[model samples]
Target chain A: MHDAVLRIAGLRTQFRTRQGTVDAVSDVSFDVRRGETVALVGESGSGKSVTALSVLQLLESTGSIADGSIVFDGRELVGLSEKEMRDVRGREISMIFQDPSTCLDPVFTIEDQLVEALTIHGTARSDARGRALELLRMVRMPDPETRLNAYPHELSGGQRQRAMIATALALDPQLIIADEPTTALDVTVQAQILDLIRTLQAETGAAVLFVTHDLGVVAEIADRVVVMYAGRVVEQGSVFQVLKDPRNPYTAALLASMPGAVAGTGQRLTPIEGVVPSLLDMPSGCRFAPRCPHAWDRCHEADPPLAAFDLNRESRCWLEVDGAVDGVGTAEVVG
Target chain B: MTTVAEQPDAGPTGGTVDGPVLEVEHLTKHFPIRTGLLQRTVGHVRAVDDVSFHIDRGETLALVGESGCGKTTTGRVVLRLIDPTSGTVRFDGQDLAEVDADELRGLRQRMQIIFQDPYSSLDPRMSTADIVGEGLAIHGMASGQAQLDRVTDLLEKVGLSARDLRKFPHQFSGGQRQRIGVARALATNPELIICDEAVSALDVSVQAQVLNLLKDLQTELGISYLFITHDLNVVRYIADRVAVMYLGQIVELAETEQLFTDPRHPYTRSLLSSVPIIDPELARATVRTPLEGDVPSPSSPPSGCRFHNRCPQAVERCRHYAPVLVDLNDGRQARECPEYRPEPFGLTAQSYRESELLNQGTEAGE
Candidate 1:
């Protein structure tokens, strides 16, 4: 396996609310290897976004990374000062958000934003414009020269996202953390963006820490998959291993819930019976036990660790521990 | 608003209605953009332009499109929430445009709409009972204890407990809140329910539960649905027929399976190919011809074919001659583009021809 571009171990991010402190991400561990796309897959409030935010140390004032080690490019980033982190942010590990409209300053033109991204990282102002134009053309932004002067609002959603990607790539960052970057886009536009990212990643050899709720997108783009539920890593494996033969009950149920997973039309989707438990009042045992059909007394009484069942395949399920066969048992559990 | 007693004798379900429950023809909605002190009309944003479709009894007809394609506008116009600039919406064989206010109100009881966001759609101030029972009281169907009873039944029907009647919208989860929305929509026993991206905001598990609930309700109540959404996967799961909209125009309309298997429109094919497949192998293997460029502004769409600019197979004729929907006589309709030729089975015409050439080469070698 290639060297990990970014490694996160025992990451526990917490938010201090008025009522109490809630652990948004608990013991979430994953790694993004060089030149590979690792998807942090989860539903809303699954703490996938928190994990991304924790890596960049960009958590809101109320939130903080309580514990964990985030090693980026063989350097510790957990206790880095804000000044030091800023130096690392745009130059080494760039981030892309769900909405490009909010990320791009409405007042500034695309050229100004891209040029600023370059200048902050020590590129000369005169040279930044040429680099910005090159980045725009690299991202396949339509009419790059014309779009460089266009304000964020003037550009279409796809164009704005392309500009955002260009800004992220302004310094040729080694790692890209994209949080649901294509969720807000139309399907066609999403496909285009996904294609662009894949192509650019191949060209630049930049590792992507892709976070998304859509499993279909994960399948489309990700080489590896890390499934999170209630701030815990429920499953982590190669895309085919996790998606085609998910060992964790939560992962299986999530797959079954998707309309595309089922055969034929109007078939009843095997839905997980309950909602994701509130972070404050999470289950004492397995967080997904309440919804898992295969959950037994052991599942409700003790939380299972993310145990490796095969090489490079891990699942947080008691069933996997008991040597349950792959594919067959998971299907029955979903049923 | 008059009481039910003072209202006319004609009710929505009073007569034996024939044909489809909802028939929309040439529905067009244009918002006039004003830019001067006098507020003079500068130009019209044609949100829904010459759109037409129908929903049969107990059938789901999904209006699928990208954002700004005007599927929601069509839904609103069909419900007469927004009056159409030019079109006829026939509900139960009565032209909605010609109907009086009182008549429209009476007809509205049989039509309900569920919005996408469960968070904002429900009144946070009102309890579940008030939210669900409001429609009942407004239509003069039930009141007081009787209204509570009906609301309770609706709650149970939509997979909620009777105890939830007194709870506020905030007390419920997103899926539960959506269930409340469904209950409120069903409170009036509406024949045609317009679900405008109803499950788009939900989690996958929650979405499945809600979709199953909706399907069960349709099976039981024979309720027709105008399911408007941008999610093609959901459309395939829920809709019997689909109308693919582009720049406020219905470019293609066909049965769900037929459309998926043998799409005749270039836009539909591109749209289908763009949807990320769940299977990893299939997702990677499928050749995707993703439509380039964002959808053009509805205010100033492309000259002839609205999709011409982004279309991969655009030709000279597509730029000058606007295509009209042509019936294929197989319960399907697609815009008549001369350049569009239906591919054989799953392969595109280009790839199929390449494979044929490869096979011929192999034969020659053999």
Candidate 2:
């Protein structure tokens, strides 16, 4: 638990479109350690997926990482070439996508996909088949023998998600990034998948970077949560701290927006007042300031940096932490 | 799709007590299927089976369930959007089930339906103004200057700007499209409007805004709503009386507050338990009774208690005799549980409380 497997410092991701360069992630930093599941959560386009892809250097060709120090096993990953990164990907650090049916090729059966993944990663055909069977069994796929021969389309949504998890765990990767893994499944099935992820994490002691918007899933699994709004980290803290006592306005709004929220009792939901501003053109002060109820006149002037917190909780906001000591100026906020 | 039944036994339409705006009695619709091309009625999908409920002059009656539970079919049948195979539908003391075709058409003007999907419900080629004013054209409500005036008024009532009247549905977002749907439903000045998952497509923020709009509209214009949705969270807040559906039948029907807090039906309890509360620690508080196995096809539903196969409380009676919607201990309460109100008298809440045994969830580790 104490071992820090991955540490990211001051990560910045940007997309240079025809209109202009838009900062998707700004000076964001967090760590995922052995046996711990850290959740990166926010609404759509809040840079949760971007942060995971940035660490993997798997961002779409048009998108690129502008600045950051990604240290895995005390080695820099930002400067690594495509060939070096390819070897590291799926072998050491793997990613399981949201929809496995899309990721799994229609032409190939479960047997073919699993065996091929093993062989490409340097394993003999017989050995790969043996290991693939084991992997299928590990994920608890019913009738593993018959399912190995069945195609992805033949399997249900839950079964396909399990197959994807099997593929991700095939190479014994140190870190696994799961992005909205259980969104497509039913509640009971979601519970099963979540339990599987937790069990796997415990057995392997592999670090996990989970990404989702469903607070319920996060509550069931996440140890710590990083809240993103627009293209920036608005709040970062322990699961208890972020969910129960969120200091950031955006985080609070998200918590309030959830259906059947007792906290939002008669208050006409002042839900993040406006639509998300286009990434091509952003506001000057805080990206969330326009929607934030707590935003003051001074907020419009400059971008707010991630202010240092006395505790582990860190927020990029103009809100005064500890009420007195202002280490940094009220700078320009991401537009 | 069927025609209204013939008269003589058209009961509720007698117009007693100045009539309920919409009252459905023993309503049932069964679709027959056959093998090969012989056209034999082998069996039926009893979509809405013996469903009976009434919407008061200005009260909203919410019908909620998971997919394929026949909730949408029930709502369509109520509006006469689809005719029921059997049972009686009385609207404003008029027996709709017995009413003739020309008479039903005239009554439809006073009863409108707002569909679930906004995109598919409206004509894509038509502009917003054309969409809203089409009803006026159809019923010959107004024309020329007066028609434009009514359409503009509806646009404002639904919170759309006057300029939006010129735009098509493609030009507006999902939330805006739903608002236009609401406006179209309102065009007829109908006393009863059925909103079939009206705000299901909208985002959380947008959903809240739409819900608030619906509440406001209800207050301003005393329109009764028959709201249908799969979202229990929304139902918990919006519904006055919720009827929990399973396998083409309402297993539980009670005041929203009572149903949510003290659910009698096992299906209702499990459905409520499955919802994810926002607060993490609180989310953990609800005793989870996870349902297993795929939902049985409505075509081949379990006999007796339709939910008995999946229900946690499947006793001997659940397999043998069908439970009737009878009065429970609570004066106004009615449930389809056999043990609820047993024979041999006026069983008060206290008497039944002593007799009925507590039930642990069906599965292990529930």
Candidate 3:
């Protein structure tokens, strides 16, 4: 595998709410290698977005990184000063949000925004416009000349998202964190955007930390998959390994619940019962044990570590403990 | 006549009416675009233009399209939530357009709507019991303990416990709020429910639970649905029949299986092929026939076929003349100009020739 571009280890983020200190992300670890897309897949309240925010150190005033290190390009991002981190944010790493309408300034033209991303990173004013145009063309936005002068509102959802991607790539950052970039788009437009991200990743060789709840998009783009459940990593592996044969019961239930394109119309999706519990008052043991079909006494007693299940796969489940006797019968535990 | 017994056995099952439960013919809804201090009507934003479809009793007929395709307008018009500029919406053998105020109020009980955003759709200040039982109170169906019992039952039916009745909408999660929305919609015992992107805002797991709940409700209650959504996967899973709309018109309609397997419209083909499959291998192997450009504005749709500007298989005929919906002998149908009808495999005449050559080569190898 290529050298890791971004590595997050033992990441624990906490928010000081009125009730108490809430642990948003707990002991979450993942890596995005050069030129590879690592998908952070989880439902809401699973801490995937919090993990992304912590890496960029963009959490709100009340929220802070309580533990762990975020190493990006051989430097620890955790303790960096605000001024220093600002330099690293757009220059080395860029983040794209789910809603393009909210992120892009309403008054400014597409040109102004793209130029600002470049110029703010110390690119020459004269050269910024040309680089902006080049990036826009790379993203395959139609009528680049006229579009550059158009406001964000004038562009369609798909077009605006393409512009957002262009802005993210303006400085040629090494790592791009896209949090549900295509969730707001239609399926067809989503496919186009996903394709654009993949093509750009290959050309720029930039590692992408794609955070989304959609499993279909994960299958389309991710080289590796990391499943988070209630502020912790439950499973991590290559895209195919994690999707095709998920080790964690949560991962399995999630896949089963998703309505596959090829599944017969008569097929009944197996829903994972219950909602994700609140982060403030999480379960004592496995966060997903409350919903896991194969959950046993051991699962509810203590949290399972991300143990190696296969050559390149890790699963956080009691059922993944090799040769260990489970609460149910003498069945050998296999991930 | 399309009978109830001949319907596809998937998702939900019950005996449908002889014809359709809700039939919308030549539907058109145009919002006036005005200007100046006087606010004189300048032109019409043709939100839904000459669209038509039907939903059978206990059947799910999904209206699938991009954002501005006017599927929501069609649904609203069917339920008479908004008065249509033109067309006939016949619900349960009564022409909704011709109904009086009192009759229309009664008809409202037979056709409810579940909106996409559960939080906003619900009144945050109202307790769950009050929100769910609002329909019953409006219809004067029950009062006091009887209404409370009905509300509790409805909540339980939608997967919420009775204890949740005292809580406010703000106390529930997105999924729970949606379930509450479902309970509210079902409170009136509607025969036809307009699910306007009801599950689109939910996560996949919660989405499954809700979809299953809808199916189970249909089977148990024999309620029909006009399922409007942009998510094709959800449409395929929940809809018995699918209608693909583009720029305010339905370009294709067919049984869900037939539509997904062999779509007969160029736009439908593009839309189907563009959906991201969950399997990495299948996604990588599949060839994409991407539609160019975004959906044109409904205010000023394209001259001939609204989809001609973005369609990959556009021709001179398609550019000059609009196509009417044509039945292709089988259960499938598509809106195509007679001169430029899609071939059996849904490819353009030019591409059909190329596919034929490829097929011949494969057959020879076999």
lDDT of each: 0.87, 0.75, 0.83
Q: In candidate 3 chain B, where is summed lDDT lowest over 10 consecutive residues?
A: B357-366
Candidate 3: where are CA atoms >4 Å away? A322-335, B1-18, B337-366
Q: How do the residues B157-258 of candidate 1 rate in per-residue lDDT, one tens digit apiece? A: 988988898899999999999999999998887889999999999999999999999998999888899999999888888999999999899999999989
Q: Please, what are the lDDT tens digits per residue for candidate 3 over residues A1-335?
A: 55888988999999999999999988988788888999999998899999998988889899999999999998999999999999988789999999997679999999999999889888899998888889889998877888899999888888999999898888889999999999888777888799889999989999999999988889889999999989999889998777776777888788778777325646578888889999778889888889878878988999888887556787888777753632222111111
Tell me candidate 3's TM-score on chain B.
0.88
Which tens-of-lDDT digit does each residue in A1-335 have in candidate 2? 34677888889998887888888877788888777889999877788999999988988878988998998867789999999998888888988888897579988999899898889889899799889999998887767888899899887677888889999998999999998897766554576688789888888778899999777677778888988877788878888777777767777776665556632243344344556665766788888888777778767878787765746778887775434333222111100
Return the clash pairs for model 2, or none. A282-A335, A283-A335, A285-A333, A302-A331, A302-A332, A302-A333, A303-A331, A303-A332, A303-A333, A304-A333
Candidate 3 recovers a fraction of native contacts equal to 0.60
User: Over the stretch A177-205, how does candidate 1's per-residue lDDT look in tens digits?
Assistant: 99999999999899989999999999999
Quote the positional error of residue A76 for candidate 3 in Å: 0.7
Q: In candidate 2, what are the lDDT values of residues B257-280, reduced to their tens digit?
A: 788778887778877776666666
The DockQ value obtained for model 2 is: 0.25
Please tell me which model should have the higher lDDT, number 2 or number 3.
Answer: 3
Using lDDT as the measure, the top candidate is 1
lDDT tens per residue, model 3, B187-262:
8778888999999888888988999999999998888999999988888888889999888888999999899888
